[model samples]
Target: MKIGLYFGTFNPIHVGHLIIANHMAENSDLEQIWMVVTPHNPLKKKNTLLDDYHRLQMVFLATESFPKIKPSDIEFKLPQPNYTVNTLAHLQEKFPQHEFALIMGEDNLNSLQKWKNYEVILQNHDIYVYPRLNSGEIDSQFINHSKIHRVGAPVIELSSTFIRESIKNNKNVVPMLPNKVWEYIDHNLFYKK
Candidate 1:
């Protein structure tokens, strides 16, 4: 199977993420879109992120209705402070039959070369990019690159930070989240600091 890995912290799996992943699954050549929930990096400074399992659960709840989209916790099992290149290599080793590609935003493309072993990633797999409002120009080397495919997905400007801050300030962000995810957060009283 051809899978597009959409990796993120998914702090609460908001609607922008859902829409982008769904668009990738339905519009691209990729047969499946795995919403990989990035595990917490112990080395990083503390933040308001939910526990890894909670974030993963939100992804699961948000994606449950989409047949081609599934939530994954593959990163949780990998080494800490892992680079995308390493994760790709690990996934390839484990799922030999499946062809894995990357799903990212145009903004990330601007800084793609800075990623560790980015050359290997481009050489080995395809990258499906979605639009991001006001993204910087992509690196020249990646422009018109055969390995890179720009998908005409809608431009999504919403972010998890915005949602979290909104919730913290007692603002209604229910429409920004999936029903189950909102319910879960509400029940848990997350981000209401």
Candidate 2:
């Protein structure tokens, strides 16, 4: 089985995240897309992040209806400040029969060089990139020798952070999240001001 690992903090799972995962599952050779919820991303801030378990539960709730989309806590048990290369290596060892691909946006594609052992990751795994709006043109030359592919998913300007802030400010967020996710957020008073 081939899997596309869509890694993110998913402080609160939202629609844009679901759309891309759905598009990937429907269009690609991938058997499923595991929303690998990172407890602590090495590249992002940690102060504002919610509890890893809580975030993971929200992801589970958001993706429960979709058979092809799964919420994973693989990184939660891994060492702190998780790195992509390490996570991929671990998953490969644990599931030797399955092939894994990296699912990310073109924005991250531009900064691939900064990731730890990025070359090893690029050389070992296939990458599926979805272009972000106005995130400058992708340089094909960088991954010329790597197995990188582009997806044709619709680009949305929405992000989890925007939805979080909206909820914090007491704004209507029905359109930004799934019904189950919105209910969970409301019940827990997540991101309350």
Best by lDDT: 1
How many angstroms is residue 8 displaced in model 1 relative to the true structure, after the best TM-score fit?
0.4
Alpha-carbon local distance difference test for all models: 0.93, 0.89
Go through the candidates in order and give the C-alpha RMSD of each one to the true structure: 0.7, 1.8
**Model 1: per-residue lDDT, tens digit, 60-118?**
89989999999999999998897999999999999999999999999899999899999
Residue 109, candidate 2: how far off, in angstroms? 0.2
lDDT score of residue 165 within candidate 1: 96
Clashing pairs in 1: none
lDDT of 1 at 62: 94
Off by over 4 Å in 1: none
lDDT by residue for model 2 (1-193), tens: 9999999989888999999999999999888999999886656766668888889998999999999999999999898778899999999999999999999998999888889998899889999988798877666666565488888888977888888889889999998898998998899888886
- Models 1 onward score TM values of 0.98, 0.94
On TM-score, the leading prediction is 1
Query: Once superposed on the true structure, which residue ranges of model 2 sit more than 4 Å away at CA?
Result: 41-46, 143-146
Q: What is the lDDT of candidate 2?
A: 0.89
